[model samples]
Target: MDFHVLELFSGIGGMHYAFRSAAVPGKVIAAMDINTNANAVYAHNFPTTSVCNNNIQSLTPEKIEKLNVNMILMSPPCQPHTRVGNRLDVDDNRSDGLQHICNLLPLCQGVQYILMENVKGFEISKAHDQFLDALRLAGYQWREFILCPTQFGIPNSRRRYYCLARKKEFCFDGGHILDDIPIEFRMGVIDGMMISNLLLPDNLIGPECYLPDKILSKRVWLMDIVTAEARKTMCFTKAYTYYSEGTGSIYCPLNKKEMDIVFAKVKELELSEESEALRLELLKSLKLRYFTPREIARLMSFPNTFEFPTETTNRQKYRFLGNSINVHVVGVLIKILCS
Candidate 1:
């Protein structure tokens, strides 16, 4: 039987794409989000699925039961937990929607599987404790992971937390629990394994967007330096494109030679196609002109076919994507839960 899914905060259907890529017999029966632009894009892409354009807090358990869903997948907004905004505001309205998920858990009468994805820092929040408590009280068996995209062979180093919970009766305790799994279990699962593993090799592009030879040569050195202060580095959420403008940008403690080479590369190209086909291809692979909406979508592992509505501004698109979850990460959790 095909598993039916309900996706909450379903920005541009990244979770939908992940479910599809998993080759599982599943269908997204319903999706909900408050952002109209995101909902427009979601509805345009998923014409048949019921798109509920409303705040998640307004959704009642009875409403969700109408979908006949067997699984629920969600990535609630992370602004409250995100270091970019107010750090620990439990009262933040942006984080309020997460409470709705907790409230709705008991209403998921037929849902055998559930997954939640969010920023890594979410684990520290009191809201996370409440969420976990709800699941445990509901007799659900669960597992969580702090996963990095690079571990999954995605080239990018986006890291996020993923949780998979299932009704106790159907739970696979051995695979779902990750306390002391084998080394094989610890290995990152890349996207290519489930879908086409094709990725643009680093050399085939132009000089404009490429990391400079010096910086490339010293990547290990930079990594070592950053490792010493990873806690500080990981907290930064500046866009890569903003590095040139000196706005919200981050920098490694690279030496003058490395910095000069990196800046030279950044200055060489406009966001145009001429200076670098590789940059263009990379943008295409990631899907966007600059590192805004598309980069966020890429980090979230949304499929190339996903589209934004023409009616929506690019800025809004970027906001929605930034708040979304990495679907590939969710898909792996689902696979393990159902195995």
Candidate 2:
């Protein structure tokens, strides 16, 4: 049987792409997000589907059930659960949307499977507790993972929390979410997966794959360095394209000796208007440049067919990608459960 999905907080339809990539016979009947940029890209990419531009809290069970959706895919906002966030958790204004979803769970009746994703700290949050309680009340069983793309051999290090829940009758544990969380979970479960196995072929890897984004300036030294043979890069957060500090890894090709000299020179100079040009010139000499939006999308496992409108800025593209999911990694999970 084909699964029908309702994607909440469906930033750019990353989960929908994963479902298609996994060869799963399903369709996302409706998707919701408040970000117009994301919704624009999503609509351009997924022309046939119904996309909602409203807040999730305004959603109701009657409206949802009418669509004949059986599965729900969500990657709720992480700001309230992130360490840099206010730590308000369920109390945060941003979390009210998810709280509304939690409130709708039991009443939706037709939903049999759900997959929710968030940052590492979310599993320990009050929001987690509240959402789990909603699942419990709705008679759903779940398996949670604190999984990284590295585990699947993808050359990026996004370790996200995924809770795959299924209705009681669909699960062997009689709908009980497992509390015995493993310290590590690997994909390619047949022979036990390795990080080296899920890599992109060499031909597909880009030319400037090792250059750090030039925008790093003096702090360019802090960019997560990696080679093509290397198996990991840092997580690309929503701020990736616009900022270099904490967003994602840059492809810096500078050697240790050159990097040391560059940083030492930066440290020796006074960090004022006079030194700014010198620092940028120094970083430029090291061949620093941000990953093009396409490369970042490739790292996230989006297929080549995916494209953004010319009107979408590089920053906007990266923002959507940063908020998106890893297609291959998520596809594996989708197949495991729905197939």
Best by TM-score: 2
Q: What's the CA RMSD of model 1 in angstroms?
A: 9.1
Alpha-carbon lDDT of model 1: 0.62
Clashing residue pairs in all predictions, respectively, total 1, 9
In candidate 2, stretches whose alpha carbon ends up further than 4 angstroms from where it belongs are 169-217, 253-283
**Model 1 TM-score (2 dp):** 0.70
What shift in Å separates residue 18 of candidate 1 from its native position after superposition? Answer: 1.0
Backbone clash tally for model 1? 1
Candidate 2 C-alpha lDDT tens digits along 277-323? 77666656665555667777877888878889778986688778888
**For every model shown, what is its TM-score relative to the native structure?**
0.70, 0.81
Q: Candidate 1 at 194: error in angstroms?
A: 18
Candidate 1 local lDDT, 81-189, one digit each (tens): 8766676646778778888778778767777888888787887788888888888777787777777665665544456777778886543344332433234444335
